[model samples]
Target: MAHLHCLPPSVEPRVSEHMPQIIDMIKQIIDSGCAYSIDGDVYFSVDKFSKYGRLSGRKLEDNRAGERVAVDSRKKNPADFALWKSAKEGEPFWGSPWGPGRPGWHIECSAMSATYLGYSFDIHGGGMDLIFPHHENEIAQSCTACENSNVSYWIHNGFVTIDSEKMSKSLGNFFTIRQVVDLYHPLALRLFLIGTHYRSPINYSDVQLEKASDRVFYVYQTLHDCEVLLSLHNNVNRKDSIPPDVKSCINKFNDEVLVSMLDDLHTPVALSALSEPLKIINDLLHTRKGKKQELRIESLAALEKTIKNLLFILGLMPTSYSEVLQQLREKALKRAKLTEDQVLQKIEERTTARMNKEYEKSDAVRKDLAAVGIALMDSPGGTSWRPAVPLAMQEQQVVAV
Candidate 1:
């Protein structure tokens, strides 16, 4: 079972403190004729509302009789939905005007959101699948209970698919947030999620994740290299101030990208803005001319600040610089433990045995190191060694050792 953390004090919604009042309002609805109580259960009369399907584009008549709609035979119409369900023999229950039973799924959100965010909140959001019975019902419940028209903005994110197929329990393609974070950098995963607009479908694949990882790595590499250069020369001066072309690029990105993000969170456009500073920083670092150390430092600092702020807004910032470095170091040390000079000495001994045509000795040594995590890669630079960890850490580890 997944362990659920209590909502942090900093983030717990302030409006949730009024749950009792919200429940009381729902009780008032039952007292009115609009809602009906049958066998200790309560249901909404959908036919009473004129704008029932505006958000989902679903028609009331088209909704057929089903298990999710109305289970109580006393419901006036199949399209009517439950406000509160009657408790079963051994199910969780809460006391209400209609006896003991839990609130219906849609009713809980309506009550909770109304209790905390007021009669009507600024915005309501969920996955696209919720537009129908879930969101539609919430709207109906809140409007009738509070005598207020519900939210001003309605946002719905798209579904995620794997291997061009819909993710489902039966197909065995469902992935948890923790599972994906274990295999890839969490920031990279966040970037991958934002690579597409929030309202558009996202297809997941190993190739896409690998590409996102590369992009994140590249951005960090540029930032790290720029910091190194700035520290080395404190007096390098900028011959020219911020270039007009660079300024224009920044402005255009802000207008295009920020506008898209503000328009119901167009994450894809926001992600595209990442390229502008990345390109500018790379060019400045590579050119490495016409700038004094102090000026270069200021310029890079400004650019880095901008990128960091934007990334934070997108929820894609690295969790911590120290944590990233520590992980890299630990991975490197594990690699070095298996393949340092000591392991190579054993390999040499086996090679000598092989020269004497003792094939068994050579094979045995290879197997021994393989068991311990040592691996050899033949390259133009001669035989180089790397750990199974990311290649970026290998050089740093070698230097430290």
Candidate 2:
């Protein structure tokens, strides 16, 4: 999780230690006439809360009444869910006025949030599956206990699915971070997750992961190219002389990126916004299409800085671009079953073939390397190779789809 840059919790609140708060919360709802106790278990009466189904957008009558009746006959309403569950044989019990019982799962969440953040707080977040019963019950519990709540926003992101089915542990379908990161780069996973809108379900597949990894490599490669070009012209101080078109492009990119982020954290569009600027930078670096050399270099420099700032906001590149590139290359080499020396040996062979004007042999060598998941990129500096997803694996994905 830390590899993904998620912050560590400041304090870990356990349900056992917060029994007092849970008991108090249960008492508040009971006193407000929204809950009732039968034997040892207490249930929150769904009929008592007028706004009970607001969060879930589910009507009380929409329940499985025609399908099957709830097994618990003691409850006043079938919709009423437990605030506390009576102790079963040999189970842990807590001291409560309603007898020795533990807090219900729903009530536990309400108590924890209300205890630390107070009955009124800014936000409450959970998955879409928790909308019904869980968050709905929480709303009923909190508001009935305190009359009002300021849980200003409710953000529910869509689930990650495996082969179009929701990935869940209970369903025996899920992937762990450790399992994935062992194969692909961690940021590739991060990129894959955020590539879609938060409200849209993202399909998890090898093809999807490979696509994300490729994009990550492209971004880092662009950054590396920028670094190389900028270093060569470090003495070129012509920021003020940047062409109007280039400045306009950078300004437009800045606006679009921020606007996309602000529009409900739409990261897909934000990520897409990087493409144009990156293309402009690459064009300036490689080709001088109808522009002064100095002006083109200056424009390239400006665009690179703008992109770096954009990357800063996105938390994409946390370290030197070359280091990340090397990490990807090293991982790629291992996957390709080739060492750096072996890659160098191939490169040397290709160089000799080309020097001797042996085109067929050079092409053969390139093809052989590519067959083992390597791509050779020829530049003025020389030829270099990086790990690439094999065409055979990608073809299998197309057939699967």
Candidate 3:
């Protein structure tokens, strides 16, 4: 089982509500002589904790002193970290038994996790950087306050790098989720993230994302084509539908694919399984075997369903049916309110102008529709029009319209 925690927006809100309880716990630890206070501030005594570096394997002597300057000067040992900091002027503060102060960084997670997940929980997870004094201190604080080790498992996800450099806002290489989603489909982004193991660092670049997008689009196109073929043969009975061998193939895929997913979320192996069924579906659609028509239809339907379900689980399904139709309707509504006949006549005129090589007139007509939020695409089959809703408006209108 897995659990997720989204921390409060600011530490101040948590401090205002939980500081008193934490202060009392610290006082109790002090009474036990495990914690000490100096100049109205409190710090945890790392030497008293027996299992201090068990997680990171950094012994006291092996620990290189952090380069960052120490914030407070009153600590007995240089490595002793603050349990509570006296509030500075104009900063958010709560009334504590010690004084008006705020809880230190490490105390919040210990207090909140204990309050919600109880003194003992199955797992704790965060970025790799937190393994240090952050998680180490959390372990010490919770074990001391709750009188039992609170967390059973500690999981840390690796960092994201860009262009062989660590992603950092100060270095100007950081990209937000919203910014990345704007450039490529969300499914492509997810595929890129999962391409590497969760414990390995992920390197970000446009070339990599483009390759991922292409692969995802190929899968989607295969599924879409299979759906179209299956819709044409739905009238066949089960026995007359796809062949027994194809049915067996699909069953095998389901069992193997599901087992992989259930084991440890092995998505890459699951994705690989798709190729076999995709090829089988394509073969059934193109082979024109009159005797196996029914079997082919069954196989096609099962394959399409499998692809759709897997894509949904991966959060990569395309826009919904109603969403696509709504976009179509909005595009139709944005045209000049010509009668059906008049619209047909305009389309004919535009077609003729293009046929006659009247490039300026053809361009003008396309621009006219574009101004009203419709876009036209020219393909070998014919012209197709879609709504040109601004990207920002598309998200808002998808739900409302």
Q: List the residue pairs that clash in candidate 3.
A: 240-294, 241-294, 241-295, 242-294, 242-295, 242-296, 243-295
Using all chains and alpha carbons, the TM-scores for the candidates as numbered come to 0.74, 0.90, 0.70
Better of 2 and 3 by lDDT: 2
Residue-by-residue lDDT tens digits, candidate 2, 251-366: 89889888988898788888888888888877776665734455877787788888878666766765777887787777678767899999899999999999999999999999
Clashing pairs in 1: 15-116, 16-116, 235-293, 236-292, 236-293, 237-291, 237-292
Clash count, predicted structure 1: 7
Q: Whole-model lDDT, candidate 2?
A: 0.81
The TM-score ranking, best first, is: 2, 1, 3
| Candidate RMSDs in order | 7.7, 3.2, 8.4
Error of 3 at 49 (Å): 1.5
Instruction: Note the clash tally of each candidate.
Output: 7, 0, 7
135-181 in candidate 1: lDDT tens per residue?
98888877777676568888898889986687888989899877775
Span of 10 residues, lowest total lDDT, candidate 1: 392-401
Off by over 4 Å in 2: 65-70, 170-172, 231-238, 290-294, 352-361, 393-401
Choose the strongest candidate by TM-score. Answer: 2
